[model samples]
Target: MIWQIELIILVLVVLFGFGALATKDLLSAAILFGAYSFLLCLLWAIMGAVDVAFTEASVGAGVSTVLIVSAVLRTTRRTDH
Candidate 1:
């Protein structure tokens, strides 16, 4: 495993984490979270933890993203005064 690649992925994870927290839109935040999960999966794969990577890819990035996006789409976005 290359340290440079690991460093890059780690940086991206941090950026995505911050982005998800800072985004105002729920959908965008969900997408960022998915990307974050995917990067973590990649890191795990590179580190030789294929099983954990697969689990994260499937459950974290895949199912969770779909569920969050669908939930966001079905809800009404309203600012009540």
Candidate 2:
């Protein structure tokens, strides 16, 4: 059961990675990156690295996402056309 849960999280992280890269909108991509980081935190916690998971959750998902979203809000989401 634990292995199955880990497997699903791993898959979700991979999917989020691809989705982040594929998204054209900066906000959407940033959100997908946050989701990827969250899944990565889960993976680390499951692997007995709770400290690393906590850091990843707080820094990667929280601070970085907020920074990215704020930057996106300040600027344009679309590229030069």
> Who wins the lDDT comparison?
2
State TM-scores per candidate: 0.88, 0.92
Candidate 2, residue 8: the lDDT equals 89
Assess candidate 2 and give its TM-score to the true structure: 0.92
Report the Cα lDDT for candidate 1.
Answer: 0.91
Show pairs that collide, candidate 1: none
Candidate 1 Cα misplacement greater than 4 A, ranges: 76-81
lDDT of 2: 0.92
Worst 10 residues of 2 by lDDT: 72-81
Tens digit of lDDT per residue, candidate 1, span 12-68? 999999998888788888999999999999999998999999999999999999998
| Candidate 2 lDDT, 1-81, residue by residue in tens | 378888889999999999998888889999999999999999989989989999999999999999999999998995544
Q: Model 1: C-alpha RMSD to truth?
A: 2.2
